[model samples]
Target: MKVAALDIDGTLYPGALGLQLLQALTANGISDKSKSEDVFKVVEKYHFNEIDFQTMATSAYTLFAEAIAGISQAVMQCIARQVWQQERTKLFPFVPKLIDILNSQGYSLVLISGSPDEIVCCLAEEFGISKYQGSIFATHQGKYTGKVNLLSGSLGKKYSIFLQMIKDWRVNLEESLAIGDSITDTALLQ
Candidate 1:
């Protein structure tokens, strides 16, 4: 199948959705005040050009990993759904039209995101994308182990994950397309 890798945060939505996920996690109590402070500081540094985007991403992901450790996937999924429902109105109007056109053309849509798997999967299902991949929080039995198995933002990680999916699904990259924004998406876009 020809693949279309779509980034969720900015491409699918009119603006960035990263903070919405963070807010959901915080509201659900997966993240504490210290973690919030740390992530905010990273954002501040990135905004001030004191640190590169990679550093900001790594720091934010680290804080997220620490905050979400040991939480059940079910709980996270619930929070993800709630967040989506609340923010659904903010989604860009053209995204669905684009998805329809892509679908009609037989492109296999995959939502590849640095966001949590819960949010990515929920959004994928809502948008009728059958496949997706996102940062995986380690799970043991039914509960989170609080460890990140693969981070989408880590250097080369997004490309590796997409490459594996391409191989496993027998996707044709020569006929595929990737849509994304931000330097974090450079690997996937390439």
Candidate 2:
């Protein structure tokens, strides 16, 4: 089967979901405002090509890890949904149509992002996608341990995930297409 590995942030949507996540965390009092400010600075630097994608991702991950450490899984999921709803209007105009076309063409759509698992899964479901890979947070007794296993934004990691997905979904690499708008997605795009 053919697959489409689509990056969520900056591909389907117009900005990083990390900002929305930070907003949600701030609203919920889970993160410090200063941490959010730091992320903004990193994003600004990245925009000017002063910093690379990995730096932005690392800063976001640090903030996310600190904010999500002790939150319960259920609460985090709820926060994720709220953030999604608030930012739903930010999606690109052609995203829904593109997804429909891909689906009609029998391509298995998979959302591959560095965003939190809950947020990415929610988005995948909202967009009618059946498969996804996202950052996983280690949980202990239903609470986040703050440790993340990010599968995106690294050299060779996305390729590894692609290989695993091939086994899981019985997909053909030669027939698959990867869509991404960042350096982090280079491995899969190649």
Candidate 3:
């Protein structure tokens, strides 16, 4: 079996899902009314503090994560579905055609994305794709516990998983193809 690993954000879609999620937050009133001004203020503060760009970005993401940490799994799933369904037209133009070609060629399709498993699964279902072979990372209950459970993402995406898939499906790695558009995906492809 030939395996094809594809990245969802920027690769399958025309843009990043993070931007879409931010848009969703704004649309759903999750964002603060002064979000833009507040972001600028935060940037200025960081600059004044001599914080590097990486540190500033990390700090911002950490705050965002903390804010959403309390969100329930069901809510996350709902938000994901709403965003994808409503914005499907914004997906990359060649995605569907590529998927069809790969599917017709008897290639095993694997979607490896940083997005949560629920969202990925929903998108796969929407596109008539079979069950995902990748792992999804998510938190259970209210506590993040700072640990990610491989439900699907970086941790779940490993050579070991690919090896297992090969054994289970009797596929040869030599014939497998891994595709991704981010540096994070290098490990899996390598």
Task: Evaluate all candidate structures by whole-model CA lDDT and list the values in order.
Answer: 0.78, 0.79, 0.60
Model 1: residues with Cα > 4 Å off, grouped in runs: 15-18, 28-30
In angstroms, give how far residue 179 of model 1 lies from its true place: 0.6
* Model 3 spans with C-alpha error above 4 angstroms: 30-64, 133-138, 142-147, 150-167
lDDT value, candidate 2, whole model: 0.79
List TM-scores for all candidates, in order. Answer: 0.89, 0.88, 0.70
**Between prediction 1 and prediction 3, which has the larger TM-score?**
1
**For residue 25, what is the lDDT in candidate 1?**
79
Give the alpha carbon lDDT tens digit for every residue of 1-190 in model 3: 7877777876787765644654576567654434423434554666698666445544444443444454565665678788878767887888888889888888888766655565667668877766454333346674333234552334334555556545667677678787777555677778
* Per-residue lDDT value at 130 in model 3: 65
Misplaced by over 4 Å in model 2 are: 48-50
Q: List the lowest-lDDT window of 10 residues for candidate 2.
A: 146-155
Candidate 3 TM-score, true structure as reference:
0.70
Per residue, candidate 2 scores C-alpha lDDT tens digits across 120-160 of: 88788898877788777788999877667664655567777
Native-to-model Cα distance after best TM-score fit, residue 110 in candidate 2, in Å: 0.8
Query: Per-residue error at 111 for model 1, in Å?
Result: 1.2
Q: List the residue pairs that clash in candidate 1.
A: 69-146
TM-score comparison, 1 vs 2, better candidate: 1
